[model samples]
Target: MVITVPATVPIESFQRLRIETYTDVAAAALLVYDYLLTFNVEKSLIWPSRWNIMKVLFLLTRYLPFVDVTLVLFYQLKTNISVETCRATYFPAGWFIVLGIMVAEIILTIRTWAIWGRSKRIGIILGVSALVAIIPTLYIEKVFLDSLVFSPYPSPATPGCLLTAGNPIIAASFVIVILFETLVLTLTLIKGVQHYRIASGRGFVSVLYRDGVVFYIYLFGISVVNLIVIVAAPRDLANLLAIFQRVMHSLLSARVLMNLREANQREYALAGMQSSPLQHLSFSQSRSSEEDRLSFRRNLDGTVIDIS
Candidate 1:
C-alpha cells in the first residue's frame, strides 16, 4: 500500500504565501517584542522573582514558534496546502512553543512547590500531574506524524494532516487541559484577590487591577472558545479562530512579560533600593556627621537608576 503526501506549493504560490506568512509573523512577534521592550519591572503585583525571569525566557522561546506556526497555518489556508504539509512545517515551529510550555511548567511547578509549601499533599498532586498530565500529552502529539487525512473526499485541495486522535483523543485532551487551566487560574485569582485586600498604601491595588482580572478573564474565555470552535465549527471558523488565537497568544504572553517586570520592581521596592533623593535627604538630616554622606553623581552603568 502507498500513502500520498502534500505536493509542495508552487514556488510562486509558496513565495507569496511565505511573504504573507512572514508579514503576519513579523506583526505578531513585534507585538510581543514591543510589550517586552516597554515592560517596566514594576507592574505584576504577584510576581515570583526567579520564576518571572524564567517566564521571560520562556516567552522569548515560545512566542516565536507561535508566530511561525501562525504563518505556516496562514500559508496552508491560503495555498490550499495539505494538512500534512501544515503538520510537517508547523511541527518544528511548534517545538519551541512546546519547549517554552515545558519550561513554564517546570518553573511554575517549582513556584507551586513553594506556594504549596508545607503541604506534601498538594506538592505531590502537582508532581504527579506534571508527570501524568503534561508529559503524556506531549508524547501523544507525536502521533500526528505519519498520520493520514481522514476527510471523506480524497482531494488535494482540502489538504491537512489527519491524526489518530481526532474525535476521542482530541476532545479528551482539550477538555482536560482546559479544565486544569481553569482550576489553576481560579486558584491564582483567589490568591491574588486576598493579597490585594491585605495590601497597604496607594497604587498597590491598581497594579493588580490593571491586567490581573482582565487578562485572566480573557485567557479563560479564549480557552473555552478555542475548545468550542475546535469541536463545533472547526473549518468554518478557521480564519477567525486563527486571528483570535494569535491575539490571545499575544495577550497571554504580554501579561507574563509585564508581570515579570512588575515582580522585579517590587523586589527593588521591598529591598529599599527604589529610593528617592528626597528620601535620602531625610536620612542625612539627623546623622549629619563626618563621612555620613556619599555622592551619587556618577552616571556610570550601575550608578544610573530609572525611577520612572
Candidate 2:
C-alpha cells in the first residue's frame, strides 16, 4: 500500500500548519539565542583546553538547526523551483539535523567518559557503540532520501517547494537515535552512582549526579516527544516538532558542557584552597641520621598518612 498525502489540503488547515511551523522555528531560534547569551561568555570559552575545544565545537552545532530552517524558509518563498530542486534543497536539512544530533551525542559521550574517570577503555567502548548506533540513522537517511516524494500545497498563493509527504522509514530513524540516547544516559547514571559510592559524596561529584541526571532526563524527554510526534502526530505538525527537537538539542548540549566545566573548576578551586594551609608542614627524612631532606607532598582529601 502506497501512502500519499493529498495534493490539495484544506486551505485553512494548510495555513494553520504553516503558522505552527513558523511559530515552532521562531521559538527554537529564541531558545538557542537565550542559552548562548546567558551562559556562554566569549572570552571565557576561548581557553585552550580539551573541554574548551569541545565547548567551541558544541557551540558551533547550535547553528545547524538555524541554518536548516533558513534554507527551508528560502525554499518556501521561491516561485520557480522544480521538484528535483526542491528535493535537493530539503536533502541537506536531514543530514544537518543528523550532524547536529551526532555532535550532541558526542558531547554526552565525553561527559560519560569524564564521569567514568576518563578511562581509555570506557571511552573507546562508548565511542564505538555510539558510532555503531549511527549506522542505522545514516542508512535510514539514505533510504528516505532515495524514496523522497513531494506534493504541492493547497494554496496558489504559497506555491514554491512542495510539502513533504513523510516516509515511514524516515520516522523510524528517530527511534534509533532515541535508543542510543537512552544507552548513553544509562551509562552516565551508572557511573555517577559508582563514583558517589567510592568517593563518599566528594566535592563537585554531585554535579555529575545532579546535572547529568537532569540534563539526560530533559533531553530524553524531548527525544521521546520527537519520536512520538514523528510516529503518531499529524503529518503537518511532525516537522515542526522535529525543529523543536533540534533546537533543544543544541541549547541543552551547550548548557551541559558549560555546567560540567564550571563544576570541575569549582571542585579544583575548593580543593586547592583547602590544601593551601598544609603546604608548609614539610617533614624531613634521614637515611643514616647525618643529613635531613625535606619532602613536600599534598593530599586534599586528608586520608594519606605520612610515615616519615
Question: What TM-scores do the predictions have?
Answer: 0.56, 0.76
lDDT, candidate 2, 209-263, per-residue tens: 5666787788789878878876777666666566667777777776665554465
How far is 107's C-alpha from truth in model 1 (Å)?
A: 5.5
lDDT tens string, model 1, 1-308?
22332344334433443444454465466656755665453233323334334445445534554555555555445435655565566566445444544553444344333322325776676667767767665665455333434222144554333321232233344455565556555555664565445443223223433444455566567657767765675332322333344455554544543553454355356436326555544332222211111111111012111112
Q: Count the backbone clashes (under 3 Å) in each candidate.
A: 12, 0
Q: In candidate 2, how many Å is residue 92 off?
A: 1.2
Ten contiguous residues with the weakest lDDT in model 1: 292-301
* Candidate 2, run of 10 with poorest lDDT: 291-300
Q: What is the Cα-based lDDT of residue 25 in candidate 2?
A: 57
* Candidate that would win on lDDT: 2
